[model samples]
Target: MAHETFLKEIGGKSVVEQIVDNITNAIINGELKPGDKIPTENELCASMGVGRNSVREAIKILGAYGVINIKRAEGTFVTQDYDSKMLFPVLYGIILQKDSANQIVELRKIIDVGILQLVIEKLDSESLYKVEQAMKDLETKITTFNVKAKDIFEADIAFHMVLVDITQNALLEGICFYVDQITRTSRMKAIEKFLTEDATEQFLLMHKEMLRVLKEKNKNEINKVVENHYQYWEKVNS
Candidate 1:
C-alpha cells in the first residue's frame, strides 16, 4: 500500500512539471547563471534519467512563462533576467477563488497611503520627474488609443508603481513589484467590466492632483488625497 501510494504521487506528476521546478530552483539559487545554455533535451533526459519527451515538455513549459528562451537551431537558454514565473499559478488561484476585487484594491491603498507619507518628505527631484514621466506616458497612451481595458489597468498599476518607487524602500518596492504582476490579469478583467470614460477622466484628474501635491510638498494633503483616490477603485469594485 505504501509503495502504491508512492507510485501514485510520482506517476500523477508530469515529468515536465518536475523539470521546471528543478530549473527554477537552480535559477533562484544562482546555480544557473542568466543566459546560461540549458542542456539539450536528449542530454537532459540522459542526465536526469527521464525520457526525452519529458525533458522537451519541461523546456516548453518554462518557455511559456518566459523563464527560458529557445532559439531556432541555436539552443534553449535560461533567461538572462527571469522573474518568478511560478508565482503566476498562485496568483491565478488567489484571483479565481477570492472573487473580491475590492480586497486587492484595499490592500494596494493601504500600502500606497503609507508610501505617500514618505514621498511627501523624501522624494527628490529625479523621483518626482520619474512620476511625471510615467503620468505623461500613460496620458499619451490614453490619447492615442481607445484605451483598452488592459491599457487602463496597466496605467493604474504604473501610476501606483511610481508612488511605490518614490518611497525608496527596497523591501516595499519589491513587494509592489510582484503585487503588480500577480494582480495584473485580474486587474485587466476588473477594468474591462468597470472602466468607462468617466473612470478615465477621474483617474487622470487624480494623477494631476497627486503631481500637484508632490510639487507643493504637502504631506497631510498627499496622504489624504492618495487614500481617497485609491478608495475610489474600491468603491468601483464595491
Candidate 2:
C-alpha cells in the first residue's frame, strides 16, 4: 500500500506488468484480502506515477483472469474465490516450454503415484464401471490406428481423469485440469509417436491390468502398475 514502492522502477519490466505483479503480490501476502476494494484508477495512476492507460490495462488483465472483479458504480474488489487462475499465463508458459517437456512428464508421474491409493479407497462400483468403460474406449481408439492423434490424446486424458475424479479432491482436480489443458498440443504429438513407434495393444493390456489391480485391492500390484505406467509414458514422451 506504499505509493513510494510503486514509484521506484527497480527493474526493466513494463509499467503495466510491474503494476500487475505488485497487486498480485499484495493479494498473495494478505495485504489485500478477498472482497477488499482496490484503489481507484485515478488514485493508482497518481500514486504509482504511471499513466491511466497502464493502470487500466493492468487491471483489465487481472479482471480477465478472475483475480479482480470490477463492478460499475461499486468498484474493483479482490475475488473471493480467487486461486491460481490468475497465474495461468505464467504456469502455462513454463509448462509448454521445450526445455520443460520432460519435467512435465516427471510431474505427472509423481502426481499419478501419489493419487493411486486415494483413488482406490474412494472408488465405488459405479466409478469402477466408468473407469473400465473409459479405458476400453481409449484402448479401442489407440489400437484401431485410424483415430487422429489429437482425439487419442483427449481420450487418454479423459480415461485418466476418471480415476482422478474418483479421488474427490478439488485441488487434485484443478491441477489435473490445468495440466491437461496447457499440454494439449505436446500431448497430441506424444500420442502420434506412441501410435507409430510403440505397442498399442500391450499398452491397452497394461491399462486392463491396472483396472484389475484396482478391483483386486492389491497394494503391491498397484505399486508395480504405477512404476510400469511411469516408464510407459516416459517412452511415449520421447
Candidate 3:
C-alpha cells in the first residue's frame, strides 16, 4: 500500500477527494464490505489526521457517489448496491455543455453495447423471459391502434431498463439510471417535435430484432441491432 506517499501531498479538495478515492479503493479491494459500518467522524478524523470538517466533507462526497449511506443514529455504512444518483452531477455538467451532449450519447451507446455483449453468455432463462415480457408490453403499447407518442416513449424506456437489470453488474446497472434520465428528456423533446405512429412501430421492430440476436447469442448481430436502434434516435435528435 502506497500509504505514506498518498498522505504526503494534500491540497485543495484534492485532499478530501483523495480520502474518498482511498475509501472507494478499499471497498473495491474488499477491505470493506456491505453492512460494514464506517468509522465514526471522530475516529475517521483521528485516523486520517484531518479536521472534522474535511472528514465530514469526504463522507458527504462519498455518500453522493453511492459508496456509502448515512443512517441517522447508526453512522455510515457501505452500500450493497450502487446508486446512480452520484452520476447526476456529471450528467448535468455534460448536459450544460451543448457540445458534450451528443458525445455523451455516443459514449452511452458504446457502454450499453459492451454491457449487453458481456452479459450475453450469462443471461439466464429467467432474464430472457423478463426481456420477452418487456417486449410484449412494448408490442401491446404500440399496437393499441391509437397509442399516444408518450406511450411509445415510455415503453422504450421500460425495455432498456429491463436490459440494465439483466446485466447483473452493479456499476453497469447504475449507469442506466443516469443515462435513461438524459435519454428520456431528449426523447420526449424529439417525440414532441415529431410524433408518429411509424416511429413507434419502427422502434418496436428494432427491439424485436435485438431480442432475436440475444436469443441466438450472436454478439456481432446484437451489436448491429443495437447500433441501428440507437442510430434511429440519433437521426431524429440530430
Clashes of each: 0, 0, 0
Better of 1 and 3 by TM-score: 3
lDDT of each: 0.70, 0.77, 0.74
Which is superior by lDDT, 1 or 2? 2
**Model 1 regions lying over 4 Å from their true place:** 1-13, 82-94, 110-209, 216-225
Instruction: Tell me how far the alpha carbon of residue 132 in candidate 1 is from the true structure, in angstroms, after superposition.
Output: 6.2
For residues 1-238, could you state the per-residue lDDT of candidate 2 as single tens digits?
Answer: 6534434353789999988988887787787889988888888887778899999999999998889999999999999874657657756776767868678777777777767778788878899999989987887788674777777777788888898889987767778888787667666665666667665666567777778878987767776787676564566556
How well does each candidate superpose onto the true structure, as a TM-score? 0.55, 0.75, 0.75
Tell me model 1's lDDT, rounded to 2 decimals: 0.70
Clashing pairs in 3: none
Candidate 1 worst ten-residue window by lDDT: 1-10
C-alpha lDDT of candidate 2 relative to the true structure: 0.77
| Shift in Å, residue 106, candidate 1 | 4.0
Global fold similarity of model 3 (TM-score)? 0.75
lDDT-better candidate, 2 vs 3: 2
Task: Report the Cα lDDT for residue 84, model 2.
Answer: 56
Better by TM-score, candidate 2 or 1: 2
